[model samples]
Target chain A: MSVIIFADQFQGKVKKSALEAVQYGAQIAQQLGVPAVAVAVGEIDGAELSALGQYGATKVLHVADARLNEPEAGAVTKIVAEAVAKENGAVIVFAHNFAGRSIAPQLSARLKAGFVAGAIGLPDTSAGFVVKKNVFSGKAFANVSITTGKKIVSVMPNTFSLNPGGGSASVEAFAAGLGDADFKIKTVKVETVSGEVPLTEAEIVVSGGRGLKGPEHWGIVEDLAHALGAATACSRPVADSGWRPHHEHVGQTGFTVRPNLYIAIGISGAIQHLAGVNGSKTIVVINKDAEAPFFKAADYGIVGDAFEVVPKLTEAVKKYKGN
Target chain B: MKILVCISKTPDTTAKIAFTDNNTKFSEAGVQFIINPYDEWYALVRALELKEAQGATVHLITVGGADTEAVIRKALALGGDEAFRVNSDSQDSFFIASQIAEIAKQEQYDIIFTGKETIDYNGSSVGGMVAELLGLPFVSIASKLDVNGGTATLKREIEGGEEVVEVSLPLVLSAQKGMAEARIPNMRGIMAARTKPLKVVEPAAAETLTSIVSFELPPAKAGVKMIPADQVEELARLLHEEAKVI
Candidate 1:
């Protein structure tokens, strides 16, 4: 038996989340006393596949199908299933991102394997295979046990720290007999956000809310985020008012983030907003309203006008960084 | 055209989360339930818009016990033609998907719509499972959708940006924000919803692969440390030295 990790890639580069998955799968393999094999599909570089070994993947299964450049869930499921069958995989690991969320469920249904999406920690095999995951939009945690013999788990991004050690993995080409039917969903166009850390993957995030007054005042938020080398986010109302794009909205009905550090500026902490960001390791709140609910949930709070405090905070961060 | 939209009830976003039965089950006491926003706002509303534009039938489906009828009726009031309640209390994602897939297979819906994920479990598993069970193509987290002829064009969020995809009819889509605007039930619609058909059906034979062993709330914060507004640099120092996160 082996643990199989889906080494998800975009434009030939492996994602940070994929490396996390590999490390997670390797830990599971250690628990089971089995090898962790990473399966890569589409147009990925051979050197990049070999580098997965540093994350504890013992071997890499490469399916060099250029068509997979745009991941069609159905087609990718078939390829992973084939890899699992060949390797006698007992557990399948994926990063619970957009691609994993789309593909893992189909794979679970196709294999009749028990799946736990958005898993936050390693499974407890001491008794049974119980995986811990956030539920209620991070308001609570659920310890879900997968009873099926074959198991699938999609680890939430940023849940685990990356620990790359010294090693090398042997890459082997695997052929998945896929047909046109497997590629039914056609990708007509692709638009990638360039030169910025994606919110979901950002280690540190700086966010603003309606208190910023308007889109023009967004520079202060962006300035702090830039100083911290973090991604920028906003509250729902700010996005609703078109002060920021919908994708930057970090709240309920938007992206859920668990960054190492999250700074909320001028945002009243609504429950819906907290649901998405409460999981951050450290929360910093800055608002003139000391009674803003966000202050109650914050680790460090500054009761001041955001227009005045944010620019100063940005300068402090830059000064701290010796810039 | 016939469309099947799946909706589920969830605790209001503000509802305090607590567990009963040795932390194995969610406590329903003092908790108000509403139609999951993603389903009601995006999936159901988008389906109603499609129905209004193309003169199609919109049917709502849910997998829950009798208490879910209120939410189902609310969905019907938002312009669904009929509704179905698969009589089961199972929280298992696969079991729920199987129940919906059985109904869709028998009814032969041209399109299946579901929320990207429920607010309670936050498991976005059912739509894909249902699609796989019926051997249909699935597109998830669709932000925008346009249908013409027998094909549908959709835009879905990728990691960094978005990708536009095209799929034929008889597919499943899990809707997210930007799909449609949320609608409220008018007085007339509310009155009409009372007389709408809500068919209760038994669940099909499906195995529940996962069970919740326990539940736990996050550790409470040790109260906020207030810093003087003028000493913003002190806050940065604490973040760097104390929090060590920077």
Candidate 2:
């Protein structure tokens, strides 16, 4: 009966991806001749949920349960699935994060809906609910049609731009009436990493590779990233060689990302690495090698040593930030 | 402890993607298919490690036609105790997940695993679907896993960092990197695998969820332009003027 949006929350605050999802869901709801409603699991302020109308939501459904706040994918999926059935929603939009990826497919199965991931842009309502998604590791695009009765799609992080209008949402409490049977799994503990932004959810990202030489030289990249309010990442070779931690690896064998601005320092663009990062909106490459393959894929390329260029770039960023 | 790791065969990472035949089917002509790299690392390696440590049975399960058997055999040669081919092409994540769930429901498996996602479609789904259908606990992207008696200790990777979690036995996990280094099969492992049992089963139903319409390659890029290395000021000016991305 409506387009349902799962508004992603981080530490009880709505993330940028959630706003984008809300905007997307609202737009789709308008196209489908239905209302745009928002769904939130765990503890979120009713006022904030009501405020999501600025991002295009008309109404918000709140399932403020303490168990929903943790890393239990099953619990979230159950609540969302039951809510979707109750709301008579035929389409559900989500931000393709860890929780979304873990929960969406299962929900699709339960609802018998067509599911898609890594989606970008608006759905082609002109043609039977077709969606554009990246395939072949961001090297290609696909226009897939969902003919099933219901549909689910997880929009890739940082892919869609959120354009909010002046409006407020009506928040109402929703009860999926879930119990212990809904829980196939439980999280005993949750370990959160502070200080650094999540790479997948970051708007801007600055990445370094083995070319940085040592950990001491990381200050340059860190400084630039901090000034830009960006997350940091590294190449697989750098992670393998111990120049950076394995989580920093971004490639086919590592994490796939799609950030608005991706800056690469001292990293030669390998095809495998490009497969992971090709989804970035604007790529900036900083390296001394003119023949670096990364330059071909970059919107901007600088042929200079990262050691020299990074410091200068960081200084410029600091000046730009007015500090 | 018998471990069954499901592996999906997909197009290589660098292949040109397109659709053919009225935009209803994926065009795989001239494309190379490999065992999903994540499956090779996470699921395959973990199964081999369990086989080595506990001297248990390790089986390779895949849902595909005859062509996929090669990769399943490769997994068998590597360390699998047996192989099972679902004997049909996977339709959607639900169709595939339901088939796997059916098989799991009929049998007893101490541990079930898979790669986090396939690179070709990047559909990081299915595993969670299977887990839900079978009513099993699942940990996504576990970089480390240990099973002692009936409990499991998993080091799962979060966005910015990692988390150490513990769960009961007979759980499911989507293995990511740092789980175990993938191993190549030696002559002994290969020879012993040739005689191992391989059972092919038919899926119970057809796909009703999703259908691929068409695919297209990414837009072509202009040639790479080089700036003088010593002209740092010029580079800054160009970033502001020509690129306008700074």
Residue A76 of model 2 has an lDDT of 75
Best by TM-score: 1
Looking at candidate 2 chain B, the ten consecutive residues that score lowest on lDDT are: B236-245
lDDT of each: 0.93, 0.80
What digit string (tens of lDDT, one per residue) describes model 2 on residues B10-128? 88766666777875677889988888988887788887887788777877789999999888888888888888889888657778888888888877787889898888777888787
After superposition, the stretches of candidate 1 with alpha carbons farther than 4 Å from their true spots are none
Backbone clashes in each candidate structure, one number apiece? 0, 1
Candidate 2, clashing residue pairs?
A: A1-A88
A149-218 in candidate 2: lDDT tens per residue? 8889888878876677789999889887878766655566567779889888887889998778877788
- Residue B50's lDDT within candidate 2 is 75
DockQ values of all predictions: 0.85, 0.60
Off by over 4 Å in 2: B14-30, B223-225, B233-246
Residue A292 of model 1, lDDT score: 98
Cα deviation in Å at residue A223, candidate 2? 2.0
